[model samples]
Structures are given as C-alpha cells and as structure tokens.
Target: MQSVGKPTGSLDPKRHLWVLGLLAPASALLPSQLVTHTGLAFFWWIGPIIVLIVIPTLDRLIGDDGTNPRDEDYERLSNDRYYRWCTYLFLPIQLIGLIIASAMWAGDDLSLADKFGLAATLGFVSGIGINAAHELGHRVEHLERWLAKVALAQSGYGHFFVEHNRGHHVRVATPEDPASARLGESLWEFLPRSVIGGFRSAVALERERLGRLGKRWFDPRNHILQAWAMTLALFATLTLLFGPQVLPWLLLQAVIGAALLETVNYVEHYGLLRERRANGLYRRCSARDSWNSDRLVTNVFLFHLQRHSDHHANPGRRYQTLRSSAQAPQLPAGYATMIVLAAIPPLWRSVMDKRVLAHYEGDITKANVLPRKRRRLLAVRRAVA
Candidate 1:
C-alpha cells in the first residue's frame, strides 16, 4: 500500500513496446499453424492457454513495477510520439487480423477443434481490441475518437465509446452504475446486468445529449447510434464477404470480448462506494474508490490500465503517464489473474470479501453489498463483533 512518487522498472518500455502487438497475430496465425504443423490438438486451447494460463504465470514470475517516473520526466513521457503511435498502429493490425482470421475460417480445411482455437484466439483479439479502443477513446482529438469507434467496431461493442466516457465514469461505484459490481453478486449474475444495462445506459445517455442539442434521438450526430451504425456496417460487410460460417465465430468473439470488458469492470469497483453527504451528493471519486494493480507485464500489454485510480481521476492523461496510488484498494494479483479468479464465484468471494471488510474496518453496511446478501452480511458482522 506504500506509494512511490515515480514508476520503477528495469524493463525498457521503449524496447518492449512491440509486446502490445503480440496479440495481433495470436488468432490470425499462431494457433492453427502450430496445431497443423505439430499435429497436436493441445494447441487448440491456445487462447485460454495464453490469457488464463500463460500471462498470469508470467505475471507472478516477473512481479510488478512500483516506482513512478520522476516529476521532471512526466512532460517528456506525455509528449512521447512512440506511445501515441503504438495506439495509432492498433487500427490496421486489428482490422487486418480480423480479415485474416475470417479468411482462415472460410478457406482453411480445419476440424471443429481448429475452429474453436480460432474463435478463442480471436476472442483475445476482441478483448485487446477494446482495450486499445479504451486508451484511444479517452483522447480528445477527432481522429483518435473515430479510431476508438473503429477499434470497438472490431468487437461489435461500439456503444462503449459513449457509455464508458459519459456514463460509467460519471456514475461509477454507485448502485446506478451497471459497470460497478455489487458485493455478494457473483460474476455470472453481474455479467448480464453489466452488459444489457450498460447498453441501455448508453442509449439513455445519448438521448440526453441529443436532447440538449435540440436534436432527436435518431440524429446522425448521436454518437451512440453512429458508433453502432459503424459496427452494423462492418458486421454486414464481413458476413457478406465471408458467408454465414463466419457468423458464429464473429458473435462468439464479440461475446468473449464484451465479457472480458465486463469482468474488468466488475473487479475495478467491486463492493466499493463513494460516500454520500447529508445533502444527497456523493463525494468525488478518488484513489480509494477503485481497485489497482501494478503488475508489470500485464500493465505494459494493457497500456497501464491496471492503474485504474489515476485513469479514472484524470481520464485525459495518456496511459504512459498513468501513475500508481497508495490509497486505492489493491488487488492481490495482476488483472489477468484477477479476471480468471472472478469467474469462480466462491473463490472470488472468499478471497475478496475479507479484503472489502478490512477496507471498511468490518463495517459491512458502509460497503455496497447486494440487496439479497445484506441481511446475511450484517449477521456475519454481528457474529464477528
């Protein structure tokens, strides 16, 4: 929980920048070729094998970067063209990767196992596709924002462009925020609420924006609709070019991508709440409101997204400049590890509930417990007392 003034790491981020591109070809080439050449079906599970198994293992082995960049270095880091181009390169790589994977699906003579491998690998692309979009979506430039939509179009979840920036960031950690997971709610229960509810929130947010402009909900300037329209167009073209066989992979990959995003949302503020004053206004978000991780490998791949507190507090800051905080609720492991652990409700609850309680000093009611679990949580608190 100790805070460092600057980020510390031995890895030269400039040299390892290509690590972000590793995901581009994961689905497009690696798995199927490895399977076909080796004649082993084990490679079929490479997607989960890489995301759930490999990354988490490496995260533990390599540990985290805890030091912040020096105060003087912030200006140079912020102005670095290398970091900007890294995100800009995302558009072609993911777009081409998707096309290549679809071509493989259409032309390759492969087994169901091969198809599954492709879908899973593409799912990882879908997940990282949105991750890249997230970094760009926070930018103010018109081109960067358009590229955000394009990146999201790859995953068919373009509404995130609107909802995340306008809604989730504004209402986060409140009961009203779909992206914020409630305590005692399992990941299974949270996923549908977050996905379906998040989309609805996006539309509502768009309606409100258009209303302010004296435009109808269907106005072309309605960013939510515009983003979705782009997604529909892309999907239509992909289906037309690749035929129906590609539909299942496309849909499954989108689902995996969305699920991955919601899982991250679930952990970022699970059981945390912003205090409301007697006047009925919640306190502004701070480091304490969100969970943070500093694991180095995943942080680099994710563009330092694990530094959630700073990102939320200063959404305009470039990822390369995001700093770690001492006050935020710290995760026991890196994001990849936490995301996997979240899939199992019992283990997730067992591991995280105690931390939540400790954060609140055993005051159960001060935290955001699920409605159904309130009485039980209170009873447990009394028993412990």
Candidate 2:
C-alpha cells in the first residue's frame, strides 16, 4: 500500500516477520525435488516457477516500503534473538537442501526439464545462501564468521569471505575495485571481471596477511585457503555419496550462484565514483556511493541488503538496523527484477545509462564509464549540445 520510494515513517519491531520469505526457497525446493522422484512432472517446475515468476511478480505489485526502524527501537531490534535465529537456522537447512537437491540431480527419474528447473532452483537458493553468508560474515563473533565461510562453501565461493571483507570493501566505488561495476560495462562484461578479479584480490589479500605473520601463502592461518579447503571437502563428500554426475550439477549451481552475486555487485555501485583527492586517495565512502533500494519483498528475503548504502557506511550494522537515506541513489526496481533486466545488455544500458547520467547531472567524466563507450558518449554530448 505504501508508494515506492516514499518513506513509511517508523517501522514496528514485530515486522521482522517479513524474513519468513527466506524459508520459501527451501519449502519450494525440498518438496519439489522429493516429489519429482515420485514421477510428478509439475513439482519439478515449482522451484523456478515460484522464485522466478511468483516472487518477481509480487515484488512489482508490492512495490517499496521505505520504512526505517525508529532510533529507540534500534538496539532492541538489532539484538533480537529471533532475527539471529532465522539466519542461524538457514545454515542447516541450506546444507540439507543441497544434499536432497544433489541426490535428486543424481537420480535418473528426473527429466532434463526437471534437472534444469532444479539447477535453476538451486542457483536461486544458493544466491540467497551467499546473502546469508554476507550477513554473518560481517559479524565479529567467531561462530558467525565461521558460519559465513560454511555458507560460502555451499556455492564454492569461499574466497568471497576474504575478498569482500579485506579487498572489495576497502576499494569499493573506485577503479581499483573489481567488484564495482564501471559505467557502460554490461553485466556480461562485468561478470568475468568481478569473478576473476575478485578471486585474485582475495588471494593477494590472504598472501599479504600471511606474509605479515612470516607464514607461507598456503599456511593454515590463511582464511581464504581455509574456505577453499572446505569447498573441496564439500564437493568430495557430495561426490562420494551421490556419484560423479552430482559434481557437475554442484558446479553449475555454484556458477549460477556466483553469477548472481556478481550481478548484485554490478547493480549496487553501478556508475557511482568517489572523488579522487589531490593526494590521489579517493574520498571516504558515504551513503551516496552505492545504489539503494527499499522494496520490502527482496529487502526482507535478502536481509535488508537492498539498503546497501547504509550497510556500506556502517559495515557492522545488523540487517534489521540498516536504514534508508533519501540522498542515496535509488534503483528502479528491487534486485530480483533488476538482475533479470541486467541480463539484456542493450535494454540495460538504455534504461540505466540515462539514470547514471542523471545521477551526475550529465557530467559523464565523473562516472567510471569504460573506454569503449567514452567516445560515443562524448559524441552524443556534442550532438545534444
């Protein structure tokens, strides 16, 4: 009922019920994967149907709810055990769902369509799985940090823990950040750069940390390598239990999940650049540096990740406490819908390029536009002049 982008003053702490959508993927997938074994053709399509179709449609119909938790409620809401338990419980559910999904993939009863839908479903769930990791990974508690690595291991993106924390966050919104999408770079171009560059950045960060401690790059203290070891163990165990065919499905789903992560990276800071100081260091990050979305559905499902600007500014802020700012650039749609739109390069540019241009009030040079599009953009400016 609230208008998209309009503030819905002070939210009730009880509204944490929105996170119930986090359970939807498991409910959709576990049953579908199991029921398909009974030769029910319709169940195979359920996961993709609910995630791709149902959620996105509802996101549109529901629009945004720009409600910030009242300051007095911040401590109570942030420290809520129920919120933490919701995320804590996701770890086991994610592990179990993966096992069931893998077994289903390895079974011969599933048709190609069934397997395809399952893989898409796994990818969809795994993307949210990484989001769960992202939330826990930021915490200072030992259990939460380890849980983050465990979640990342599910999608074979364990290195994300190191790169995102030590590397990407340190260099976000600058040319130095591979995870930050440059203006005019399509999602296809951004994906390889983010994925490969992000991995390399993680390795370098870990290698540096080890060097400071006079240890080898592959030292046991290296958290990045530790995460990868967990991934290898997960794959090996799954293979031994479910046969070699399950390995490909796991890998495919991992790629899909990783791509989904990079897609978020692409959209979050697209075309936003920090000011380079005379000393050559970029200005400090603020709410203005990242794109913000307040759509309630995806925000709840992803744990308020849509309020990215506040998260970037205060990395340790619990998801329940992240607030939206009117000054931060707003996305045209929630992440799920925007991610699908980002897949089509021309349509993405047509819709988003003008937004980037508008954000800077047509100061094209202020954006991180790629070299290939620079000449054309300049020509367009000249023609318009």
Candidate 3:
C-alpha cells in the first residue's frame, strides 16, 4: 500500500473519476425516473437516502486514500481544465433537476409525503452544489465566479459567494467569525446565527469595498446584490413556468439546502480558536485551526472540502490540488457521518467536545466556548484543577 504521505508523482490517479462529481445531481433525478416507471413513492427520497446513508457507509468502507499530491504536481493539477469542467457541469445539471422537481410538484398525483421526499432529495443536491460553488467562488476566473452564483441560486444562498471568501475565510476560527461554531453551540443554534450573520457581513464587506472605490453601499456594482438578483430571477421564472403549485416546495427545498450548508459551516470550525496578539489582531489561520478529514468518498463528493485545513491555508487553491495535513485535527469520520452527528446536539458534543478540549491541551479557556456556557465550563475547569 502507498503511504498516505507519499506523493504518487505527476499523474493524478483519480483524474478520470472526477466526473463522479456530477453523480449527486444526476443520480438524484434517476429516482424520479424510477418513480415514473414503478410508481414507487419511496424513489423520491433516494437522494437523501444516498447522502445520509449510502455516502457515509461508502466512506467507512472505502476509507481515506490520503495521497497528498507532490508539490511538483500541484501546478499541473490546478491548471487542469478537465477538473474545472467537472465542477462547471454541475450548474446545468442542478438547474435541470430543480426544473424537473418543479414539474413534479406541479403535478397532482403525488401524496404530501412524496412531495416532501422529492423536496429533500433536491435539497441535498442543491446543498452539495453549494460546495461546488465554494470551489468556483474562490477562483480568480470571472466565468467560474458567475457560475458559482448560478449554483447558489437553487439554495437562495447567493450571499455565500461574498461572505465565505471575504468574511469566513478572513476571520475563520476566531470568536468574531460567525461561521465558526462555538464549543457549546448546537447545529440548531449555529444555523440561524451563521446564516443571518453571514448575510449581514457580506453586505458590509461589499459596501466597504465599494466605498473605497467611491461607489455607494447599495450601488449596482455590489456583487452581493448581483448574486441575489440571479436567485430572485430564477425563483420568479420557475414560478411563472411551473405555476404557483411549485412555488412553496421551491421555497421549502431552498430552506433545506441553506440549512445543510450552514450545518457544514457548524462542523468546519467547531470550538477552534485563533489566538489574538496583545495588539488585538488574531493570528493568521493555519491547518490546526480547521478540522480535516481524509475520507475518500466525501473528499470526492465535496471536491476535497474535507481537506479543510489546507483550504484555509490556501483559500484560493483549486480543490484538485488541496492536500491533506498531518498537523490538522482529524474528524472521526467523513462529513457525511459528522453532519448527521451534528444534527443531534448531545451526540455532536459528546463526540467533538473531547477532541476540542484535547486540541487545546485540556485547557477549556483556549477553546471558543459559547458565551452563555463559559461560566459553567470555567466552574467545571476549576473543580478539575
């Protein structure tokens, strides 16, 4: 077996497999086809079933390949248009799936359960598509950035393009970073805070940028509004074409997609903190500040997002070249499993709290605790001392 740390040289062994990135959106539509032929309502939920169950199971069985590309290979891999096209393909497929879902919702034959199952299925696709957008949004290319917003339209999370690159990447793992979940914060609490705070921060960051360029805060040049306009136009056009019957389900799926995206946000930096200097500046982000998982299936599905520690260190790095870090904290499993764990607060805390505490060398003060829980954590710390 190849050592996890050893580079496999110039050729990326996984080169041809990248087309699997489209598997999520395309496979999701497959079940609806099955439903059409077999009249099985359960087919609608296949997307969620695959994400919540199959992916995690496959992750466990396949395990992490853990091949960090040789430094020499980075340029070649990053410049590979093949990988870029794989991600670019997701946008059209995702949009088509949403349209198909709308057509289904517009039909009268489906039961309410079937309707929600289909909604959830598409929600999973759109939520994962946000990961694709994250990959695209970080690039210097103009077309990729535009497609990133198009991918986000299904989730109604267009603000993510501005906030993630500017706000989350800039302040990640710090107390001021709303995207980073605190030690005592559950997925439920973190979702609304991150989602709302991110939107506000994106607007402010864009306004500040525009102001320096002599543009108004609400100027047409604000890319944040541009992204939102794409979403609004998409929803309006879909409603007009599919009729009002598809509108409510469209909104429902959007909520689920956004919720899933925020849940991943909750997982990425839970309880991690970047120390501030005496001069009041936070330390520069490094691998240790973000969670890392090398699970191969998820690394593929999410386009190497689970190699998150490297991502923070190289925010603009192409996903194809993102490396696994030996120093970064490792999750017990891939994001597929951890995301499920995060949804249940007690389970999330039970599994992750000890890791955070250990990462800080058992010093509770070093972790970012939820504000209200700090006193209680300190009391327990004193008792242990």
Best by TM-score: 3
C-alpha TM-score for every candidate: 0.94, 0.93, 0.97
Off by over 4 Å in 1: 1-15, 18-27
Error of 2 at 285 (Å): 0.9
Candidate 2: stretches off by over 4 Å: 1-14, 24-28, 31-42
Number of the candidate with higher TM-score, 2 or 3: 3
Off by over 4 Å in 3: 1-5
Error (Å) of candidate 2 at residue 378 is 2.2
The sequence of per-residue lDDT tens digits that candidate 2 reaches over residues 163-269 is 99899888989888999998889999999999999999988888888999999976788898888898999989999999999988898888888888899899999
Give the TM-score ranking, best first. Answer: 3, 1, 2
Ten consecutive residues with minimal summed lDDT in candidate 3? 1-10
Enumerate clash totals for all models, in the order shown: 7, 0, 0
Cα lDDT of candidate 1 equals 0.82
The predicted structure with the larger lDDT, 1 or 3, is 3
lDDT of 3 at 99: 88
For candidate 2, the per-residue lDDT at 11 reads 53
